[model samples]
Target: MTAVRPWDAFTSAEAEVRAMVADPRWQGLSLHDRAHVLAVRILVTPDGDRWLFGAHARWHLHDPADGRWHPAPPPRGTRARQGRHPSAELPLDVIPDGPDFLAEPGSTQAFIGPDVSERLTEQLRVLLRAAGRKSELEYPLTAFGEIFASDVPSTVAAVWGAIMWCAYAPAFDGNERLITVFGEYLRRPLPGDEWVRWLPTPPLVDLVTLVTERARAGRSRAALRLAAVMADTAQILLSDTRFRPRALALLTMVEPVLREPTLDAGLDDDEAVRRAWLERCPARLCRALMGETDREAHFSHAVYDLVEALQFARDPRQAAATFLADLSDSRGALPARLDHRLRLAYEELDRAGLTGTSAGESTEPDGFPVPGRVLTMPAPVTEVAPPDRASAAAVLGAAYATGLAWGGLTGAKVPERGLAGQAALVRRLIHERDDDHF
Candidate 1:
């Protein structure tokens, strides 16, 4: 397959030296007088092609059939005269920093070392570029229950396996989405009783053993995937008192990986949030069902963009919308609907409370922090009306920022808002159309 240079992966050695040196990937490296030698780790996708990632600026594709590497813009090194048959076989071709600007792949200095941070960062960037049209950031922060819905169980299992295997870096909160997704990778659905009939009673033990062995053998990626799977497994076992022994055993097995710094891992994380939400969800639901008053269900599901939550709640109004909502409309809500729910919940979370956590504490039981009212007052209704300053300000805080930023952005670019005098034409048309319709 053709390997394209990822737009984000193109910075010169001099320009990115500081950032690279600080990276865990470049640990214990001395470049002194020599040029940069990128330890390219090729990620072989399902399409029988590979993407070589790690070089500072350049990219490569290796054809497995004959075992050859190909770089874009034919290399012009000492090996250039040798004919580019096998990239690995090619001689170290150091060209000056001119038109054929980038370094050659077969430079004697080039070697293969699997990088953790830089490699994962590039992988995530590539996924964003390929899978999404926009969003340097992506998805619901942590939905431990969702990966079971994926159709590709084996693939999911394998990917999670790799992540759990390789995820040993200290608490890295740089990419919330990536870390969250890594945890989600473990959300692989557990096989039913029938699927597990052949195994020991508590299958998690054998699974943990296998994962531990793999991790010891330097299979970090697979280890990561298993870590995710075990996380969900532990979540399911949260209510099983009898299974405590097995559950504790499972936790012990995966504790090493969990110790690695990850926002989605550790005691206060998505699982905590999930468990807390689950514990209170039923009570919140009952409250919503009981509401016969003019008041909305303060603790309902409307606040969370349940669908977006399934994906990282990236919609901005995430401030106001993510907290308390109509538990009844738990799936999702529009900005307006979410706003309404927040107002409703705000009134009831405490007769005198702000955003209702049963005890009026900031974080709920499961480690999910309930957001206080970002908008102290309700947003004014706008129906061809003047913009409400409080409503707009609330938007910056609790509501969507882009929803309002668009006015200036669009105006500077194409000025879609028409002339003020056009109102006369609009009024005339309304009058004319009213008579025509009647």
Candidate 2:
């Protein structure tokens, strides 16, 4: 197969970066820096529609045998010579300061302006629609469940999660029909149980051994990243009240050291920690179901028990509970309604009795739910929707700020700082207090 050209990769990367920067959550982030750019690449999809534009801080590595440092090959097949190939059409050296000019790939600097954004958005809209349609036709429920159960590399799982989230999230509009179709795909069953039989068991011990070995060898970055991903995945599972007991058990067994605060203290790198945590998750789950005769039956029971608790509880429950309940009953209220199938699956889990622990055993507490009447609750007062685009933008801006803060992205940073400040400025710029229409 012919390698994809550097020019094409450059264009693709640029588009991905632009889309991320355009997002409200990323408005404050510095896209020009290499680290930020690399982070964005990890976050964004690299298919034709998505691209990232930013500089990579390249370093030359010296060979001990040779006195000189050699530059790595230009990402395989990419020729350094300018103007040599027909595909090398991008102006690789032009840097434009304003919104008027588009970025040239291989340039020292460039900004993707409005034209590129418009073009890429149109292209992505088409591609995303096509993907949503294809996913509806191809991906089966069993495949998704297998993904949950399989011992696939944590990186692959993270990519899958990000892809599904981006494809289904409400932040990007104009694809309601596609979202609906994809939702159907998630609900159907896969080809067979044979696929599941091949699932790899949790590699918790192996991961622990790897981390220990790597740390001994002084490759801390790899270990940290893996550990962070594991921790993050564990936190995600732990937050789900339905999965709390099993998650807790799995976490304890995988990283017995985590039970002590100091040993797990440096698990702050989100991705690595999540991976480390997930390495043990399957085994923990299996152990939890040790006495159960039917695995599916066990899962179903755990879900229903949790849902029942949520539905009948007098006080606020965990965020996961509220999220799950909203998923099962008020589909329209969810930001990603495509997740409804997963929610229903969990609800079925509750009915299956898998949630019941050994007699009289108490599970650890999870998070508290957001307080509010459910979306289906009857409105006691007249509902007054925001009147103008400015107001709408302000609301969204505030929500984004709040979400960032809640998710721990903003540390030691005040709400009045950074992009939140910019958003405030934009609100003032478009202020229309007198007339409701923006």
Candidate 3:
């Protein structure tokens, strides 16, 4: 940490910051207690400028004369001044996990200027220490190093964003906004030297756990936004061999949310971000997702999610066919009815112009691809393949492979089952879940 501190200009930089937030006492705090530090705003100014932090909507300036910092008096017009807020008072324990990320947005100062980055850097260090993230120590340092040199604003933003979001999520009400800021920053082009080299650092895997646990508990938006951030971070690292595994781990964590049946994954605008994520996906990540279709992780995903993402593939058709084969080859037996429905759905899409040979482009909206496990199946009218004796299990006890395919094609949506059919399909699915718990 000292290596990156600006020693040339500020003769007593390190001493000043340490005085405000003592190292020994800070180090003794647990994860939850340290997390309350998130409510504090620690900012620094340009090199050679004053250092500061905020609490209770007021500011505290570091006093260089005495090497200690204290809250300043308010303006003359203000009423009796209040002492330090309860948050500033050290509590016995600060629980790390909670229902929301920022249940309490604390601040003592109205304005904590930007230069306190090094101070923020110290806070981040304390966090890692409490979380036992010795492996991630260097990342915050890199962030501070860049901010100190005034080199790359983008890199600084990534580091700050990752750390802050980690501290503020779930119980922190401001988590959504913080996550949004982080995602937007990462979406821009951050070179290899700027961010990815720091990937094995923080946001650590703890964030992944947070999203996985509370996503369904009304934090879906926050969770998905973080997913997008992780996705964007993964995109940045895609080309770097050193960080590629870390990138893959990030994407793997979001797969569950991507499998939401509504395809919204809890957000209305999830599709656009979802598409961008799919386009940047590495083939290896894609294969790993397909592997998750085995019996054990079946309920872990929505059947059509991966299939829908394949539209952006370099070879959409091949990906689709392979994924189809993956499903067939996976653990449970493919219900012939559903398999036939899926093949027909693919056939319909082909007929509608998705020759399964699209070159990484959008498929026709009306192409109508169907998933094996759909809440509602599009009612398409076509000639059914006359079943062979064994294939027609209607009267038989056992069955055999039927090489024969469906008969001559007919056309048109079943007019009788248009909107009402969809509504009925949903009703059935809802009732099944409600009644039998299936």
Candidate 4:
């Protein structure tokens, strides 16, 4: 490890801390076991660094960016005390991803006050070291690098938000207040940036697993809130090129959930449930099928329309017959695979006695061709589309990560005044860093 200690102005119990928590004997323990050792108290900084206190009041500053500890000055201000100090005993959940909160007073001091157990600091060292190895990110702790120095504040905020959400989701408890806070953050503009990036897949998996557990435990409100946050996150993933592929992956994961009938537990009206199901499934199916639209655009989506129609009709068998007749009219021009699936679908319906006529039967002489797919199928009713089960659950995993990040960084709200506000924050950080240097 590098040994760049802080300037003499910074007071710390670094030597004592190292001797206590970094013992050679401790080195033999696995990271997981070391994490559970209760030995230090922690203080989190507004900018996302951590202050670790070990035995005999020994303390060190941990820069998550470098996975290194430095001598730290004692806590001196309100901001330092207000910053999050997660229990050393609880499982570590937050990632130290950040757009420095230099605008907040005492944000500098926010790096020093804290409470946590001993092995926890050691566990964090292990985590930060692992993170440094695995992630391509090289965040700045004391200076603005080329990428961040030139970027706009909004981009910084958005990227920071995305990283925090994706990284810290495993610790999210699905609280409604936190969900509201996340929703408000989402309302801010999230322009994409090339410089800052992270994989959405791992967090997505982590979140989905958590939500599945919550749902299994019958925590309906928590499950729904978690799902809502994920859906909210999808709005960001869909708009950014960097995140679109992961967004598509999210859609694929949730497709089965969409295919199932909408739950009637929270929903009261059968019509409302069907309408909600129709609204979510079709658009998702279209996005998923975008890669398959080469031969016949209309025929490629025939199955989705059939699914929608079957979902809405009073008698699914009769609905299937009507859809097959529409399919039969265009059968000659259909893609071979689509033609094959359609044939199988027709036979499946025929076997169930759901078809009104054989596949080759002629259409009614005055039959108005069902124009523009199943959306125009003989119904005149219109229903508003709202978030439902599958739509919310689609991005659940990612949402939880981002949500926890937000909760952890509750002290560092992004400025609303655009570049001027961000410029000011950066200036403060620079001023603080330069002023503190020997």
Per-prediction backbone clash count = 35, 45, 28, 14
Displacement of residue 17 (Cα, Å) in model 1 is: 41
Q: What are the per-residue Cα lDDT tens digits for candidate 4 across 4-58?
A: 8644311332344334354656547654544444223355545565665432222
What does the lDDT read for residue 212 in candidate 2? 42
Q: Which candidate should be chosen as best, given lDDT against the real structure?
A: 4
Give per-model TM-scores: 0.18, 0.20, 0.19, 0.19
Instruction: Quote the lDDT for 420 in model 2.
Output: 24
lDDT per residue for candidate 1 within 382-403, as digits (tens), equals 1111123222212211111111
Q: Give the winner by TM-score.
A: 2
lDDT against true structure, model 3: 0.29
- Model 4 segments more than 4 A misplaced: 1-13, 24-206, 209-421, 425-438
For model 1, state the Cα shift of residue 404 in Å: 24
- For candidate 3, give the lDDT of residue 7: 32
Q: Which scores better on TM-score, 2 or 3? A: 2
C-alpha local distance difference test of each model? 0.27, 0.29, 0.29, 0.30
- Candidate 3 global Cα RMSD: 29.5
Task: Give the runs in model 1 whose Cα sits over 4 Å from its true position.
Answer: 1-121, 125-225, 228-438
Candidate 2, which segments miss by more than 4 Å at Cα?
Answer: 1-203, 206-213, 253-438
TM-score of 1: 0.18
lDDT of 2: 0.29
